[model samples]
Target: MKYLMPFLGLVALLACRGKNVEGKNMGKEIVEIKKENTSQGVDTLSQEPRLKTFKGLADTTFVRLADFSDGFAFDLRYATENNFLKAKVYDCAECYTRVKTAKALIAANKDFLDKGVKIKFYDCYRPNSVQYKMWEIVPNPQYVANPDKGSIHNKGGAVDITLVDMQGNELDMGTDFDYFGKRAYHDNTDLPEEILANRKLLKETMESHGFWSIRTEWWHYNLSAASNDKVANFKWECND
Candidate 1:
């Protein structure tokens, strides 16, 4: 049966109420979206056994890394041989929210890309261990929460990204990747108009495809309903 899920944008939550035989609106039901909760422990499509190696990030036909022109691209750090950003140093690829969504995002905004707004990814799939490290680095209640708590990145449910120019030059997003400061938050009003506008564009576009952004970081977006289960509960390892 086709299921109807409430769409939660980048920051707002949706309340879903059901009607019983009485035809009355049921009470408010808050659907908790967990990054790593899957049903039947299967992949979204082929159900090709889920990857759980937590090794360095590798792109497969399934884990397509696309660009503005729908051209496939590798993680910059990986292409440059940056091991830390890789699986061991940071293994979090298997939980990816399917490449199809990225294509949809591009198709939805063909004009933006043609105008030179390319999607630049800071981080994609991440290992749960790496997430622990990030939590250790921040540790603030308002920021990282708890290392043990983990994050959507650990489940491949989230992506840290920004915009780039047609020439592949990164735009000024006020701060670099993993910049721990007040400026990263979406509501930070101290930034310049250009920066804010750039962020807004990124946010609006991603949210249009059912992705949600973290409040502290404009670059981070969590994929809601990316899987059949409302969470990234499935465990993934490298196919290699």
Candidate 2:
């Protein structure tokens, strides 16, 4: 919702207090809204976070996902020592994506929510510098992208993610994030029915949103239109 300035004088706007003038509001109420009352929309002034708007942001701008919506969960393994690298490389645990990627993710997540699950991000928008660190640990180009050319992650258009129930329990997708084996391959359908179903759900949903998964990693996805985008080392500021 927009925080509209009272353009007309108090007496003029008295009866139309909760209305929009033609030159004023974008069809929303032109009144002060209590932050607590906004259960389903963005509230920029609220101490409690409401979903934020992407009004003025560029499509290429990097943004924190948390600032947009509280509908998703994050378990950033790279920020901790839990990833395959077994090294903590990030300054903090935060999920960011390019505006286009973020928009696509948000749309896909809404679809997931309708299926009683939501998107849980493991990694998003890795810095090119972090790509170098990952390459140092695992020099294999197959497993880790060479930092010189940079990965889609460095371009802010790739993410490692999974599905979680509303209760925050993960859907079993055969292998954990970053599992480097045939078991992790998307083509490995020899697994149980439940696992294949989970993988199918994730793959189809993401693909519908302009994302494509790599054959080796069921959890990895790249925004189809963002592959040729330039790599960036845009680091986010961590709160104290």
Candidate 3:
């Protein structure tokens, strides 16, 4: 029986692999993209189990984006006291989004990586409970969305992000994330050309991947398909 078990395990391992979703440069494939820095000539790719974990997940299922690809970066401000709330509401720093939103993010990251940059997340998939917490900190509808009427973040469809060069340096977007002012508005054009260019890159690429940007926050994006998803209260457990 011991020998049979080993043989069966080997068969299972073999059967679990070998399905490669061929990727192209325009961002169709998820983990198969071997991004080469257009200027520096650097590249990366990995065919690991994590990349296939989404195979059977429903599009509406909330998932950790990192589980599917290592092509992006995260800051997760709300996990720390760096955000506008000036409070650490989340117990841990993790980025989760609905499967559909995640796929769009992965596709957007692929395009960003090709441009020698990647998306750095500030926030993703906030629990509706956290929304109430944020609202308690700032009840104004101008900044914090009313928890009574859940925001897109609670729906696992919104992301607060910015671009980081391959060197892990954030691009100059004219203002830090969660900044509340005219400077952060998407229509605010009184900025330097470089800053505008950087924002343009992040905006246009995300738009191409089915995300729409809000008028007031350049860092915010919402998946058009996830607008109607129910507000989720699933809290993440911190691993010791």
TM-score to native of every candidate shown: 0.54, 0.81, 0.79
Clashing pairs in 3: none
Stretches > 4 Å off in candidate 1:
1-62, 66-88, 91-96, 99-111, 133-148, 227-240
Question: How does model 2 score by TM-score?
Answer: 0.81
lDDT of 1 at 22: 26
Is candidate 1 or 3 superior in lDDT?
3
Model 1: worst 10 consecutive residues (lDDT sum): 26-35
Those runs of model 2 whose alpha carbons end farther than 4 Å from true positions after fitting are 1-47
- Is candidate 1 or 2 superior in TM-score? 2
Which structure is stronger by TM-score: 2 or 3? 2
lDDT of 3 at 93: 98
Query: What does each candidate score in C-alpha RMSD?
Result: 24.2, 13.3, 15.6
Question: Per-residue lDDT for 1-240 in model 1, tens only?
Answer: 133343344124322222242234222221112212245453443554333331343322124333223532234442232433323343343224445444444453464576666676666655555556555654575655354655655455567677777777777888876566798888898989998888888888888777888788887787674433222333345455
Sort order, TM-score high to low: 2, 3, 1
Q: What residue runs in model 3 are displaced by over 4 Å at the alpha carbon?
A: 1-50
Q: Mind sharing the TM-score for model 1?
A: 0.54
lDDT per residue for candidate 2 within 1-240, as digits (tens), equals 133445445557665765545436643444434433565466655566468899999999999998898899999999999988999999999999999999999999999999999999999999999999998899999899999999999999999999999999999998899999999999998999999999999999999999999999999999998888999999998897
